[model samples]
Target: MAEKIIKGIVIDRFNFRDFDLIVSLATNFGVIKMVARGVRRPTSKNIYILNPGCLGEFEIFLARYSNKLSKLKKGECFFNLDLNDKKIYAFWKLVSQITRETNFVPKIFPILEQSFAKINSKNADAIKVYTIINWIKFNGWIANLTRCRVCKTNQRLINFNFYGGMECVYHQNPKPFFRFGRKELEIFYWSSSNLNTFLEKVDFDYIYLVFEILKQFLKQNSYIFL
Candidate 1:
């Protein structure tokens, strides 16, 4: 077996047997599950590295079936990510949402790592963290939240048709389509902005609203709530 190290975020966990855990990790390669024996026990030396949000250097011994599902030979915590209680919960919520919404794990790992680093930073702004998440949803190759799919307009009051592209209210029947509010549009625009100053200046209410909108959008399209 070849030994290798990979950094990842624990997206989900399930108890196996006798203090062991099966963790689903979102790594740069993709979503991979690994068994961490004895991780649940208080005396387990690997306990520190098995946490949900911790970015760690996992030493994996590639079993023939490791690519399918197997246990790592050993693991170590590279970054424990000392976060406040609120931030920790928020981080976990974001991770859970991401895991639920899409299967494009490999592509999202870089963005996830960046978000985690920001959340763990001493000067990290909660609003900025929220903005980063919203930004990725809009700009990601998979989602592409910008520009109406039909008219390709950058207008705020977009008419969302799940199958077709977004249409401007003027271009479509207003009653049937869902409208993304001005504030919500601003949040998306600001989230995708290149200026770091805008990220820091976003209001909390708008941030929360953006999250709600994205969650609803995901639910509408994929029947999944993030």
Candidate 2:
């Protein structure tokens, strides 16, 4: 294939051989894996752009007749979050853990980019939760939190099942993954809104709750992760 440029995030990277690296990039097309040859060498300029959560445009190539791994020729970093902060680091780590080519979607790329761009010291916690929720929603795994899955009533959706379904107290899963009280339910309610509004309305105290809930939600939905 001719050389092409793709704008995306470096979701995961690992040393391949002596001086090469393998990276997974989440792009509009899909989750693409490419080998960056000799990027680990002292003379290489592309090494730093392989960091997880680095947003950049990569020049890539593949030969039509070959079945070998695709090649990443060079990269130009747009920006990368400061990975030293614990929350920011955790957010990118979670992103790498869940994202995969088999589960790829077009909207995933922009959502990841937007979340990385918008996150900062002030709103790191909420932004991480917001991005995961958005990812879950876009992947069509999020349940209708507004109504009970079985009873079809909106009231008292106090239980969340592992399969991503909601149920009221009147109808509950035999082994529900999470049982939400009024407060937890409230947190989940606003989590569906746009990121900015969610950050504005939800107290910092509740952001951790949302993050825990989303974490468990994904834990149960293991197939969604890589």
- Mind giving the per-residue lDDT tens digits that candidate 1 earns over 105-201? 4655665666665554333444434534443464342233456656677675454443343456666555643565666555554544433444565
The lDDT for every candidate, in the order shown, is 0.59, 0.74
Q: Judged by lDDT against the true structure, how good is candidate 1?
A: 0.59
TM-score for each model: 0.67, 0.73
User: Which tens-of-lDDT digit does each residue in 26-129 have in candidate 2?
Assistant: 88877777899999999987788888878999899954543467789889898898889887777767676656665566776766777776888778877777
**Which number leads on TM-score?**
2
Going through the candidates in the order shown, the clash numbers are: 2, 1
Estimate the overall C-alpha local distance difference test score of candidate 2.
0.74
Worst 10 residues of 2 by lDDT: 217-226
- Candidate 1: worst 10 consecutive residues by lDDT? 135-144
